[model samples]
Target: MSTTTGLWLFRRLWKPAEGTPVKAVVVFLHGYGEYIDRYDAAASVFARSGIVFWGFDFEGHGRSDGERGFVTEAGFDAFTDDAEQALRLAARQFPGLPIFVMGHSLGGLVAVRLGARLAKAAEAVDAEAGAPLFGRIKGFLLSAPAIEVDPAVAQPHLVFIARVLGSCMPRIRLGGIPAGDLSNNATVNDHYSRDSMNNTRPFAARFASGVLAATEAVPGIAADFTWPLLGMQDEGDKTTVPGACERFVHTCGSPDAAFKLLRGRKHELFMADGYEDLITGTIMPWIEERCETAEPEAGGAAAAEAGLARDGMSGDRDDEAEPTDVDAVKTTTSEEPVLGAAV
Candidate 1:
């Protein structure tokens, strides 16, 4: 699918199993320097579970048209606007299905803001409008969201210098993330290095500045978040700050929010070893439970309860450790052996 939101953005949808009825729509937001294809494995899981999965390349990444890694127009707003366009497309393609927005890394930051905006919009009365533009959003799923940049990439003086340079040369490429830091699986790392659509090139100065600003602003809006949220982060992740994810989940106003800190996983949790079953054990069940309900207004208690049960909290485990916030839980697991084939 393509949308003409100022610039054309490329998107694709993964339908549910042939004989299955579509129960809900999930809009996936890929991480920075990555594209929609990275989530194909997870999409299949969602599809088989009777949910429609769709995602798009952010303006300058993947198959989308734009200068690589650069937010050429509207600054950071361009990304959020692109997300809205994706939501509109989802609504048009499968009207009335409860929509869930899922984001990873930088996309996670976008999802947080998008979810908050939609939740707020659902409450206002529009005299001339038939329905709110974002009334269908039911929840959010975030994986290692870039609410705060890793310290290695967020040096104050350097970021300040980059911001200054961006003002004059917004399109100048700065530097890109190391592929090794993305995952523990060698095959996944090699695949990312070889994928042409993956933006391995250095980020444009303006794009870096925009991302920094957006990430910094996410925590401030946590008070406004009021939808069911499931956030997962790998403690071993070097690509984004895990502490920030923990803080966001704890502080966010959503009564149904739950955070899981995977012990030996990396930035891309869905692509990590044992991730397939992890989704079956956690994410899939969460979505299915909510989709089965006609109205999600009362979903908070049920979602939280279901999440706790799936994490095996019902029974004691020696590897489990609790975070500072009672709401956030930490579970430690031995690293899963790397697969011989690429994810």
Candidate 2:
């Protein structure tokens, strides 16, 4: 409904139903080279659920007015600070609705760290309150959280350089890998390209540093986060290490965390084929469950059915260790199939 800009900020808003009980606020963090506008459909899904949806284009992404695809170590700290400011603004606008955060791709990493930081901050603000803004977070929905690295894919030397020389060279190109390198589902790429229109590939210093910081901080964040959490992982994602996303859910501070596998989905599960059901059925129900007054048990049977790791893999699978679906993509030479194009 409104746009706002400030020091290192880009935000957009959508109002909830008039006089409707503001169930909760959903703040979406878009991933690398992504803009908030891409979430229009997702936001509508939340609106139908009686939640207000707000999000921003991260620095260097979309129309944020920064060097495209660049981020440095210090820049990440600044980015989080800016994100907090946006949250504060949300508080002012929505008065008392519960708040939740969701992230996709690289954004998931940001949400994890933010949840931790918010938890600590909330602790300090109202130590006696049952659920301060921190614990009050209804839940976090992280789609294809980018954690760990796939051994099969060739590592990008430039990405490595940015991590090392982030301070010196904060601005660089971080895109332009191949389809197989990024995702096993070509349809995902097709949708991404069609929806985004501009396929600029640039990397920034802060992006690398932000990633480094997120990697080290996410586990601690997960360990400390007591709020409910839902993590959805695509079995065929190539950009993000797969098992790592699911592992994040199981290891979170909350024993009641839920993890779901979007059958045959890829990195951007929401963008994959048959994703409508994902948003309307699985995801919406998870969020709705959180809005309820009672904190029900999470994913009792779903987690087990989704194939939880019972061994010492610790979320990392062997390079050659491909499950049937993953291996199908890895071994087959045919053009990668898109899951949700017809939808």
Over 1-343, each residue of candidate 1 has an lDDT whose tens digit, in order, gives 4434466666766676455666787889989888876676667667766677777778888766787888865788778878877887777866678888998988998988887777667667663462534556668888888888767768889899889878998888888888876765667787788877788999899998898888778877898887878888887788888677878877888766667667666787777766766666668777776667643221111111111122211101112222221125322234321111112
Tens-digit per-residue lDDT, 195-247, candidate 2: 44233465555566566656766766777775667777877676788788777
Clashing pairs in 1: none
Give residue 15's lDDT in candidate 2 (0 to 100): 50
Top candidate by lDDT: 1
What is the lDDT of every predicted structure here?
0.71, 0.59
What's each prediction's TM-score?
Answer: 0.82, 0.73
lDDT of 2: 0.59
